[model samples]
Target: MVKIRLKKFGAAKRPCYRIVVQDSRKPRDGTTIEEIGTYQPVTQEGENQFTVNEERAKYWISVGAQPTETVKKLFSKKNLNKK
Candidate 1:
């Protein structure tokens, strides 16, 4: 199964994440099928915290890509929870 989830990155105390599409069997930071967006949880309020490619996200979800819990919330914020 394909999943839409966060890929961890950044320094020891600062974490950034990439919202990516990957196979369910793979490791968390393993090879991804596509990167549809990004998330920076530690960013300032005025700065953009996350971004999602609506078109691509819809396409992936349409094809049965399941978003993890956290990713689902992000989708809900953007009103992309169609499935």
Candidate 2:
């Protein structure tokens, strides 16, 4: 099954992630179908986060891409409201 999930990257102490579309069975950082957006944690700046390409995100959902629990929460927080 296709899924929307996070692909972890960056240095050990400084972490960053790319939100991507990939096969569910693949590794988190393995081959991806497409990159939708990103997420970054900000300890220095309060409440710094965002999501992009909501239209594409919803398109993927319509075509049967599942989302991991964490991705689902992120979508909810962004108000994507995909089902």
- Residues 1-83 of candidate 1 have per-residue lDDT tens digits of 99999999999878999999999999999999999999999987699998999999999999999999999999999999995
Error of 2 at 48 (Å): 3.8
Q: Pick the candidate with the highest lDDT.
A: 1
lDDT of each: 0.95, 0.85
- Once model 1 is optimally superposed onto the true structure by TM-score, how far is the C-alpha of residue 68 displaced, in angstroms? 0.3
Give per-residue CA lDDT, model 2, range 1-83, as digits (tens): 99999999888877788899999899999999999998876446665665668988999998999888888888998777555
Candidate 2, 32: how far from true, in Å?
0.5
Q: What TM-score against the true fold does each predicted structure earn?
A: 0.96, 0.87
